[model samples]
Target chain A: MTTATTTDLYPTRGTAEVLTPRQDPVVWGAPGTTGPLRPSELGDFDRDGFLPVDALIGPEDVARYHAELERLCADPAVRADERSIVEAKSRDIRSVFEVHKISPVFAELVRDPRVVDRARQILGSDVYVHQSRINVKPGFGASGFYWHSDFETWHAEDGLPRMRAVSVSIALTENHDTNGGLMIMPGSHRTFLGCAGATPEDNYKKSLQMQDAGTPSHTALTELAGRHGIRLFTGQPGSAVWFDCNCMHGSGDNITPYPRSNVFIVFNSVENAAVEPFAAPVRRPEFIGARDFTPVR
Target chain B: MTTATTTDLYPTRGTAEVLTPRQDPVVWGAPGTTGPLRPSELGDFDRDGFLPVDALIGPEDVARYHAELERLCADPAVRADERSIVEAKSRDIRSVFEVHKISPVFAELVRDPRVVDRARQILGSDVYVHQSRINVKPGFGASGFYWHSDFETWHAEDGLPRMRAVSVSIALTENHDTNGGLMIMPGSHRTFLGCAGATPEDNYKKSLQMQDAGTPSHTALTELAGRHGIRLFTGQPGSAVWFDCNCMHGSGDNITPYPRSNVFIVFNSVENAAVEPFAAPVRRPEFIGARDFTPVR
Candidate 1:
């Protein structure tokens, strides 16, 4: 069983007592309600480092959470806070953080049984929210993020210990053609796409042309695209995608009138918790890099 | 030059790249307005493992925060959630968490300049809130606590790497002798009081009489108590106490007619952030053991 272990890289710790109380695998739902996903369901994730989640929130819950997301995004502070970004032309909220901290409804979404129960099955034992945000693509030429893997930034910038983490993106609105849906190269996670310099101020713009000599060269990613094949993650509202942190992925700009908003949450194994980041001198604010590591019950 | 490094245990890290980008000493405030404290100011924290702040939150701010605390105590969900506890006879609120996630007022307190600046200086960089609670000791014979160190609970249960953490308790009401104020051993943090069982359901009580074989024995603690005299932390409204997470400490019951309420927050160095607990199968819920490690700016 893969577990969160300690790194011996640093030299000053006093004792082995530092790594105590190993976590136990948690059973999900009632015996029959939902044990775990079928092998077929996780096949893609096992091979490609990501999986698709269907009907996670259902219609009613999706509506509720979507409304909450909108309300939180409307809050001026969300935009003012460093975590929020705008789609220049549309002037709409592009991303927001600690939504669970602001709205009681969003807080409920963070604890939704549908999400929590499944996450436990995949990661084993209890899982704590490493990071939570709503990536909003305001339509009619709204921005789309370019190719990048989360772990590259997470490990380098946020200090996440290992790749024992995955992200769940619950589409608040339909993400279809013309709206710039997510795209990933099957099995690209196996390759370590080295990154250079910290992700520039904003993620969407900088990610596209940010690579350097040591980073993922366009030539290499192009080869993987031809060999492994690229897949599109387009779905209806309430549908979700769970991707490994190491998977190289990105999306194109949206020119459709329809907007695409998805609540993205990164869940890390309690065993694989993070330390201080190794990437740069300045770290992102709490709105960006979470500080609390308590597991969700 | 003391910095937060890694624990020596757990041997499976894949790379030396696991640890990178050492933490820098963050400047607390504008140049010269009020710089870091002098060596003498932190003499107690360095020598005795604790420091006392005479007036952190001003009377006006304390009044405001105290009002917010009472309002939250009345929240139905707050009472229903496992985090809140009552003193039995007094029926007063004992503890609560995610207060910053709920109330905007409490959220502001989480970012209070006074609390953040000093914590950064001591921690040597940006710091994040590890745990936050309101401990209430209602008068007329309200309950008091026994002795124990925070790191004992944090390390054994929460997987914190080092004791690079501190607790700030700001008195909302006057903490007097009759009210069963906090009592702590002067320099107990230097020694590690290993614990076995998980920290009990509630901190206010179990802390008073909790410990077993694998943990530090009472007989051993008694000897230390004799050598290092215990000091009572009693003060007026707005006064605060900053103590090392490893310091042996606890408080007493309040038999007086007066009541004592305080806002207690735990701050850990960003570089020394935590992972999921390692102690056992089940773990503390998000309310009790937070997972977010975002440093407060």
Candidate 2:
């Protein structure tokens, strides 16, 4: 009998596909007892692997976040910072990592209870920012991310050993259905898809702009989508979605004039801090996957 | 009785000075049986906490490395790279992190058994690059680093939990006595000096150029120097020194016409991977302290 160790629980980037049952509990705390999430809401999140909340913040906060995003993108110093990943073809600012460190506005938003409380509830422990970024999908030929589970990449490259992390994506601009909004396969987080192919050396240098290393193959994507069905998230500004790290998700290209932007923050349980990568040649940069595990006060 | 857990073993940045005994072994293997370093050499290292090796690389390799350094410094793309840290006063390139990824020559040097074999022996396990950089001190008015234990700052900010790391400094230029060579307090690595004052938030942004947070006070420096006499290192190009992570060391400013340059590489054992910072509010960038723990093959 083949036994699995803690380190090799969800192995990915192997030669062939190997789907393992999700080993860790999806909702860490007992239903209804944790943070700001209600029992029904927690049940919905556990069942669907994603929970969408309306009016996560007031309209004023969304405006402030939007203004900060514009200011950051226009600043030359921020553009020069290595954390800013520029798109390959469009030459536009694709994503800015460590927004909390760069801007006080976002830093305040990160610590705000409205956002962090639910993450703490879902994660079931004191959490730290594993990674935080502002993704900018500009109109006119903006690229779309291929379908993949983030936990696959995080496990293979960042050395996160479990699915105890959660992603909080708050919409700054209106997420219209026609504008490239996020899409996820509901209930797919129950299975850990071990992707085929090795993560290229220094894959992060290019993967940040255009990722293909840990993306699911067509067969796997088709099966998952067919099994769980795809759910598109389209909502107004101030809406937010909290999704499990392993949820199969991706977005489309934004060719329309409306640019889509969101503040993406990842919270990982301090107990699940990273080690050496499972399948990657090296660990990614700190800005991409934080080395700090200090709990948010 | 206060029993120290594994995480809080080497506590630093506390208000009071706490000198913990070194818990891990200095050298991993039996002296004579280890890699390139001999028994006598290992004894010297264990006794003094530092060892100087003669002729680590031949003249041709030194010349090639020097040429590559010049080429990298002169390249506009490298200058623009955020990894390049410019001197505050001179505006000359001070240091460049992750040179292995940027240059094939340095990458090959990192993988070379001559440099890495000794590290594996001393660290007692497979080692990986915790950090790599080329430090360039321009001849006129280049600033010097203050006397401080690297482990103090590393533990406080970079989240390195132990002293199972060694720094390899290979001279790329002639190190004359007047040209600001490195100075160390011999045998000082036995005691860990927990410095006073909290680490300033986002200290790495400034500490890289002028560090003040984790440095020892003048009183502490006097005591350490008096207890263990200081030793200066002056050698020809291609000579190298391997020093413990906790060695108290610094250098003087370079005012002489001859500039001093060296390739600095830090190797940490995979068994001694980093965790959350014990004191610092946030972890430094990955270029400064790598999150990757993949052992060198």
Candidate 3:
């Protein structure tokens, strides 16, 4: 494979430093270990394969990252397709990794000792970055993403990292039910629901079922939230939710005209691993620019 | 934004000529002139917002594309993280556009009168290439990707283009239920289910419902398939599927140890509109060389 340029592969000198203490030297007990996260807080994570941590970042830091994103989105050098431009222009723009590069706030959030300690306790080892992305869904301009699991897209491998993979999303905005907030399927991750594996012939029939079922599923979940007590993580800027990647999740359309933004970072263990970027039928242009990027090893 | 080089934006001299014949003239008809698509065929796409056409490209062509993809994947110059390599790799690899760029096979497939006729009937106007992509899902080596909708990912501006869009995928391998296969929610395209307005709070609870519900909505659909007398579309390599962008669709895991690959191309009207590539948040180092790419317009 082609090698990345020095600049593209290594962290820039101006890269942001994570302000939180690293858990590298600290070995903490399970989720309940003294810290912000409680063992019960991670209860869902254990049974269902994912959990959402509330408000990992604060509003001031969110505002700063938003400002940086605004600058980047405004850069003329960045040429996006009409659709992408429209999406970016309609929302507050920011790069997930860029914030980590420029601000100690993001770095600290990603490296938060409590979060990391919990990750290790739940996952059983150190986790590495699978990828990081920024979500900028502008009011009325936000695209309603679909609901699906992160693991379903892969070609199963022998040495694949365990299902312990987790995706942590840090809300830079107060994500509510109206502004294109993230939606997820709770316990779906726990069981290996045999792949639907619809055939070309079966696709049409299966699709109909999915559509019909989607509504009731939504209602069922809504009702359960009211009864069973659903948690609304109205995280202040800088706060985040780290959940299992396998959990079914998606976001609704942005109802308000304001931008609803967040940063999503995925982590997986490196031991006995054979992970690569998920392949799409098409390549994303922005990602192409960072093809040479590599984490400091 | 940095402008794409003319060479990278437009097809090379020989490439443009190759695609000419496939450029079947789009026939416009009065709105509602064409009869509605078959109800059984219309799954989530009809309800959610999209449709699917099976076997758009033949098996032979799919095999050839697969061979080329294998070569590309094995190429040392292709690294997931290297932008410069990705740029160069683009030239060596066979893009869907390039396939039509040099071969009559692709052109014939693009202009397949049956497919175009359907587009004309559905869109009420002539359609053209919005973008074409080569999706190579290498087994074991690939990472799991997110579940999302093509239309929701990109936004449109006033006077932009019709919200209706179609994607034609040509199967490159004999995909079975065992291997990761495509799944869809039928009839989802037409109705704006409550999900359209769901939020983060909805997501937390929705996830819980999925866990409580015990099985995914798709499971119900699978059982209903036979009861509804609906037909599945799994087939040989030559088969293809055409569907709406807004349709709820996803692929299953490649349980088998082989790659599940395919070629995806989208056709859209350019009238009073501009077509551009989708911009993603992460940057890949390889696409820098592609800076020279120009649009066909």
Best model number under DockQ: 3
For residues A69-98, write the lDDT of model 1, one tens digit per residue.
Answer: 887788887778766666555667777766
lDDT of 3 by residue, A4-57 (tens): 532211111122211111112112234345545566766656554456655455
Q: Model 1, residue A113: what's the lDDT?
A: 79
Each model's number of backbone clashes? 26, 0, 102
Q: Could you report the Cα RMSD, in angstroms, for every candidate shown?
A: 28.6, 25.6, 21.4
DockQ of every candidate = 0.01, 0.01, 0.01
Residue B190 shift from truth in candidate 2, angstroms: 84
| Candidate 3 wrongly placed segments (more than 4 Å) | A1-36, A48-50, A78-109, A112-115, A154-160, A193-235, A275-297, B1-297
Error of 3 at B218 (Å): 38
Q: What is the alpha-carbon RMSD of candidate 1 to the true structure? A: 28.6
Sorted on lDDT, best first, the list reads 2, 1, 3
DockQ of 1: 0.01
- The complex in candidate 3 yields a DockQ of 0.01
